[model samples]
Target chain A: MNFFGIPDIYLVILGLLFLSIIMAIIRVIKGPTAPDRIVGLDTINTIVIVSMIIFGLAAGSVIYVDVAIVYAFLSFISTLFIAKYLEGGEF
Target chain B: MLNQLIDIVIYILLAIGVFFNILAGIGLLRFPDVYTRLHAGTKCTTFGSIFLCGSVILYGLRMWILGNVDGSIWVIHTGIALVAILLTNPTGAHALARAAHRSGVKPVGAVIDELENKPTKKSANKMEAKK
Candidate 1:
């Protein structure tokens, strides 16, 4: 009933998260504009952070949640940088 | 009995979070143009993350009340992560929206844009070049 020591409910939640990530990736692939793709990327980043937290809970570890925190900030910075680049302005 | 109640609450929170996330994904696919997609992608995910992280925090609190020291760490770190998400999600969305507008992506079916004639730094430069 346990896969990699994760309970069934947590596994289900993770699977659903994966599905949502796939959907976001689809948008990324099909988007016509750069900003659209960036939007999809942002969504994926947030979902990935949530999934990491769930995995941390399932595995009874704290490190994954900590990593998720770092990932969130890094992704936010990257999003802003990309936005600035799209704006085509200095810095 | 109390443990069961706590578990039920956690499951409810998780379900709510997952539902909103799925809705966000669907919205991203279904919405037209950049602004609407950004609307879907940003607000839904931020709301979902709140509930998801809330569940984890609740679970950690439950464990702590049961005398487990590790639960404190879980609660603290997850809370930090939640705060990080809360702080960054909207700011990033706003930046993206502004960038989209500045880069000339217009909203679908809009009759007028109020910011079009507004004098931003870039627009000022354009005006100077025209003169």
Candidate 2:
């Protein structure tokens, strides 16, 4: 009933994640300047978090979800720090 | 029959979640400005997470209805995670946008120089000139 018992479903989700990564690469390459790259990276990080959640569901381990939650906060911090750096001010 | 309905709901939620997530990624790639990109990136993923987590919760509830205890744990934990995302994601986007604007990234097609017009830097320069 569960396609390949979650693994296959996740394999398909991973394929989508791959597609997203390619699109992010395009933006990174074509972005006009630095902030654009930061924006792109931020977007990629969010997408990665979602994928991690899906992977957790596939594995039914819940640990992946825990990792996802931590990663979410870490990425938020990183994005803020990068943005502050971009703002050219003391943080 | 109710159990069948729950199963249907779970599958629908799964598709919806994955679809919106993909949309988020596409929007992130397609949008033209930093602000727009941030909007796409932040909002799409937020909506997607709701659906994805709901699917998991639905599955858990179905199991609980069928008498498994683990489903309740899954449901409760997913709820907490969703709450975390709801509280934090938009704030992060706001902070990033504010930082970008303060750093001098003008919105596309804007006709104002409000942030720069306070003359703080220029006034200091003028004082240096007068002295």
Error of 2 at A77 (Å): 1.3
DockQ of 2: 0.58
Clashing pairs in 1: none
CAPRI-style quality class for the chain A–B interface of candidate 2 = medium
On the 0 to 100 scale, the lDDT of residue A32 in model 2 is 86
lDDT of 1 by residue, B109-129 (tens): 888889877777887998899
The interface root-mean-square deviation of each model, in the order shown, is: 0.6, 2.1
Model 1 lDDT tens row, A12-87: 9999999999999999999999999999999999999999999999898899998999999999999999999999
lDDT (tens digit, per residue) of candidate 2 on A1-91:
4665665555776687668767777787888878778777877777777677667777777777777778878888888788778766445
TM-score to true structure, per model: 0.96, 0.83
RMSD of 2: 3.3
Give the per-prediction TM-score of chain B.
0.93, 0.82
